[model samples]
Target: MWGSAGIVKPGLERINRLLSFLGHPQRNYLSIQITGTNGKGSTAVLLHNLLNAGGFRPGLFTSPHLVSPEERIRVSGRVYPGQLEKEVRDLGKRFLRRHPSFRKDPPTFFELVTGLALKHFSEEGVEVAVLETGLGGRLDAVTASEPRIVVLTTVSLDHQEFLGANLEEILLEKVAPDRGGCLVAGEVPQYLIRLILMRKRKVGGDLFTTGRDLFVWRNGKGSFDFSVRGEIIEGVSPVKGTGFQAGNALLALAAFSCVAGSVSGKRGERLLKVLEETVIPGRFEVVPGHTTVVLDVGHNLEAVKAFCREAGKLECRGRRVLVFSLMKNRDPLSLLRTWGEVADDIIYVELGEMFHPFRRIREVSSLLGVKVLVAKSLRDALSRGKKIAGSGGCVMVVGSHYLVGEYYRLEGKTADI
Candidate 1:
């Protein structure tokens, strides 16, 4: 049983090394590499849904599954645990034997998991797979897959230590090496476009604005009336979360257009209806408990911004209680400051299961300008958060998907949190 700590690292070197020894299984199925600071999960979901609707067997690979690792690899919205495990075992056995050099490093957790996904997707004969990057762009395990289509959902300043100091540098590392046509949410940094042209000798991957291309203006009944467009065609997202979900939906629309030829406006409409009905648990998910609780995996500035913006719009008249934790690399102070203005009281807790340390939990939340409570653990935080919500107000738990996954683990689920 190789566990998480032994498996994680800086880049694709381990996977690349492992795959080269095993004969590169990632190339077997067409995969679109989805890279960005935010929206990777939702974009991957949209990509998976669109391809499945187009009569294609598509696999979706994402991280920190809201409920289970089974959520990480899906074909046509169905998770195949038995099939996934078989592929993982086969690949794990072979890769370990074949890559003696990488064995010293042990192919960090994400790299091993990615290898498992590639093997599963390949063995399943999936027509396509959406590979959402774990962190940063360059040297990530997904880069070893060398996708045919590179999709940038959006880039913002996050992951400062490994991804570089500024947006331009981050964009260069993320988008420059992209070999194929890109599909981006409109208006990436000017420098990123320049680098893409420099590398591929081409231009144009930008779609329309998030609000324009995939809009959720409002329905009279308090639900959202939304539409997502790509290449002059529009699809509706039935499952609504926040306005930023539009960006992810539109990213999917562009991906579908780029690969499958535009969806027949009629098929697309039906697809849109199907999409609107999608339920990705824990992502802006409003769970009906004793009090209303919204769970999100917003680990960075841009993601936190989107979640807080949407959280502010909720019609609940009660106090807004926030239970939060973040990774060491995230902008915790800045994120908490932003959440501070919107949330009524903040409950800070540690995510013990991640690569980060526990003290960072208190350090970051201390920067907030409001009343902050420190919980010994996630369960304690949830108990306190619920008490603060007190049968009336809204309780929001957010931070990293690691935090969300940790929550799922405490809830007694069968899969990886």
Candidate 2:
């Protein structure tokens, strides 16, 4: 069903056909659909945690698992049991046997996984499920669930080739799943906000936005306070990424308020307590040791800019070294320049066969027009970064999630960091 590893086919026909044949398990429970350029995964995860804390069984479906494929479909932040996998696989076989035509044209990887998650959520009796789109919103497989509430995180230029060239076009593609429940958005340009408002009006949906409907501010210690319609929840999030994460947390809170009622007083405090302890892997994850190492999956320009901003806020005693790699299609020069602005030294490495056909390290170094270190492997890159960082220095691994996963696998470390 997959033509290439990263190629995206945006439509609903394939997934709809498959789900229809599978008894429409997505219809059994309520859903919240999240889609945007970035922070969708974090928002889904945070929302899952909050809902689970509030005594609800919420299933979460996200993409690009850090370690295991089972990470894509989680119940209460844990992978589903082996029986679910067996059930899904057996169901798929039965479906193909009943409809021989499907054997020739099977569902795509993401579509199959999404179907499995929906079935698992239904069988497990989850009250609600959080679905993060694999690609743009309009035709993503998650849209097949027809979510009641939709949250649009920070929208920026990332998948331009598939989505659009400009913000307006991209917004149009991402906002197509809006079916008029509650549309919660992060801080975006006024024009994009107007477009969202227009969509809300068309769908007859309520709109809540950061700095307007909902407000979040970070304190000196990096903990955040969330305010919505005069009700303030103090010390909401302790997740230390960029300031953008505060906005993501607010989006999650706003979404929770939409489905589960307003968050205030004791309930708000409980949610904050859960948020205070939540740590999303590969999003500014800091590993403590003799030399500090940071792992982040900030691939796009906006995400990388946020990473740079957060890196500048670190209280490092020595130089800030960056270890980076990117897929072949990504714009490396722009990301490299953004990292160069905050990093004292940069090391480029080959991600090997897993992320093969990657951009050559020498070509990237040549484009930067600077003396950048090139490593043969991720382990070598980490070693070189630590040496360059010296004592009390900081080393940052960024650009792509694949790079971070490779590092974890090579170092025999868990992706749960």
Top model by lDDT, which number? 2
Residue-level lDDT of model 2, residues 180-230, one tens digit each, is 887888888988998888878888878888778888877667567788766
Q: What are the C-alpha RMSDs, in order, of all predicted structures?
A: 3.8, 2.4
- Single out the weakest 10-residue window by summed lDDT for candidate 1: 230-239
For every model shown, what is its TM-score relative to the native structure?
0.84, 0.93
Residue 199 alpha-carbon offset, candidate 1, angstroms: 4.2
lDDT for 113 (candidate 1): 73
lDDT score for residue 165 of model 1: 98
Candidate 1 Cα deviation (angstroms), residue 155: 1.0
lDDT against the true structure, per candidate, is: 0.70, 0.81
Off-target runs (Cα >4 Å) in candidate 2 are: 1-7, 83-93, 219-222, 240-244, 353-360
Residue 165, model 1: Cα distance from true site in angstroms = 1.9
Please report how far candidate 2 places residue 270 from its true position, in Å: 0.9
**In candidate 1, how many Å is residue 327 off?**
2.8
**Which residues of candidate 1, in runs, are more than 4 Å off?**
1-8, 83-93, 185-187, 190-238, 353-368, 410-417
- Lowest lDDT sum, 10 consecutive residues, model 2, at 352-361
User: What's the residue-level lDDT of 10 in candidate 2?
Assistant: 74
